[model samples]
Target: MGDTDGAEKLLEEAFYNQPFNKDIVTLVFSFYMDTADYRKLIKVAQRCMAFHLADRLCWHRLGTAHFYIGEYQSAVLAFRRSLEIEHNPKASFGLSQPLLALGLYEEGFNRFEERFVANPSINWIRAEKMHMPKWQGEPLAGKSILIWSEQGLGDSIQFSRLLAVLSAQGALVDLILHPHHSDLEGVLSTVAGINSIILIAGNRFKLQRRYDYHCPMMSLMGILKLTPAIEVANEAYISTPASHKNKWFEYQERPEKKIGIVWSTALSDAFLKEHPMHAAAKVKKSIALRQLEPLFHLSHCCFFPLQIAISEEDRQYLSKYDNICDVSEKLSTFSDTAAMIDEMDLVISIDTSVAHLAGAMGKETINLLGYVSDWRWQQNREDTPWYASMSLYQQTFEGNWEQPVNKLVRLLQ
Candidate 1:
């Protein structure tokens, strides 16, 4: 039997007995990274760096740990140290995130291409194999361009605003989306400039129509020379169908104010294990149902759970509150979710697709973020450039939701 507990115990004993053993230290560090124990990874990485200060691998690991904990400056320094030892593509790519988060767009976007080089399996990398010419910031007056989706659903929703800008420039835009986003086909089709929405599934991608030029959706930032000034000024572009909008109103009794809540994320343990870098943010972004009990105490405010899938524990927790309604079963599609959000007075959620959907819908949203949030949220800000109606409430420190939750309670009161 493959016993993880037994293996962990044996590793601990080996580390204790041979504290200075490089093999043991490396193994322990790998274990922590695999398990998503970032706190322990930081401690172990620091110890490894102390013993092997000049080792590029140690510096890279230390940088990664610092990056996870929101220590951007420290991470930058550590990655720089690793680069000094050797020109590492992964370290160079790792350096781009914090720089981008700090609003160093030019430098960050310049180095952002390293992501495709580092992660060979990324969608953009596959898109590169199509042998199509990438569309730069050139005149597209008579050109047909393919804008393929990359990363998560939230990313696609956030960047979809740029499609309108491209369309206004007289370019025929073809959008290639993931199959999971099929629900958005009807909603996105309504966008002025989109010529087609092709969903990638099985071997269906090979049969897609051609375009004059192609670009990844994220590349639009660099291509259009997006700055905070331009981004913040952008308004909500997503629209809801009349049928879907009416369905939401018909399904529910009108409350004084409908507040939507998403306490957790959809990122599975398997996905986190594969992409350890996102693990820390994922952990910090999700809050337990009990932690949000403070908000539930507010009177005259009806809370609706916007999550598509609810764990049994959360289901039981939700059942205890009359004011908190579970509408997960009814939310079969992203359009349905958008419709419910359109009906909401406010959307209070942790970092999730719901937040993006609500923000894109121009809903008054209070987005609760972790101490170290994704690059899009930026740092030390109460409002985001991505959504004008959305207000951000970030954690003052790691693993402390009390402060943000208290701030939210006061806002609600």
Candidate 2:
């Protein structure tokens, strides 16, 4: 903490001494970026651009700051200007995010490939070892294709709709997924065209059969020419086993409106250190247990905690509420969470896997988002095209959940 304070103080003094110096400006901007201080980054970026009007790096910094704040239009313009000065792969990739967020599907989808090309350390790229050619929207009739899961479990669930599409195209679809997601085999087996589901053995994948082509699950969006509506329309695609649903029902007493709530997102230590902006936003997304006091005042509504893990502080805080059922112990896997969500009238959650699960399952999910949410939620939207059954309640101002929570309270009433 002292080192951080000292570094910040030095940067501030440098900026004050050489207000128009590009090097000092760059250093200060980088400091704010590393700290995930977007507001300060914006102010510094604007000041830097005032003097270094022709600097491509300054424009790139400005664009990144705007992107983090959910200002897509400004981000787009800033990125474009940076590119006009010098064609940069990183800047090009940055441009795609805002384009996708604004629903410019074609351009965004086309440019999204830059992510893999620019950042080789991305999880999907690291896991991939296949030397085979990637399928590029070609006719797959009589061709065998492998679709491998990438990113988070929620991403795998959300993109699993493409398996049926691949099957419909007459391609033999073989899926490779994480072993932990084995519970989904029964659910996904029902998709029309899947020939087999293979789980990754430890960190390595061994395939029994060779395929003509392989594609990452998310690549289907661009390769298959999918529209947002088509993506969200597959509401009945994922279903909880009847037995699991029945078990959940028997386990808990029924309420008029059983609202499943997930307060905080799980973040690994390494991930938080690597992505300070995401870490900062995650802290903001974690609404305090006491902040939800207004919802408990409503009649005939019971809140079920769907988080898999909770901090000791949170556990002790939740002990105060009798109406809020602590089901964290019972939620051992995604399947268990799904089964409970299957019985819920409404799911009120932060931007987490639970929101994705409820959305994919076609549950009426009210997803609470931070001021600047994930790109999937898009910008300034109440409803997402990614999930027809999901309604987004975003923070109008940073760190303020009062408005969205009050909206939720009114809805519950």
Best by TM-score: 2
The lowest-lDDT stretch of 10 consecutive residues in candidate 1 is 200-209
Q: Rate the local accuracy (lDDT) of all candidates.
A: 0.80, 0.80
Candidate 1 residue-wise lDDT at 203? 28
For model 1, the local distance difference test gives: 0.80
lDDT of 2 at 352: 80
Off by over 4 Å in 1: 1-22, 251-253, 269-281
What is the alpha-carbon lDDT of model 2 when measured against the actual structure? 0.80
Which residue pairs clash within candidate 2? none
**At residue 194, what lDDT does model 1 achieve?**
87
lDDT of 2 by residue, 301-360 (tens): 878899977888888887776667788898876778888888788899998878888887
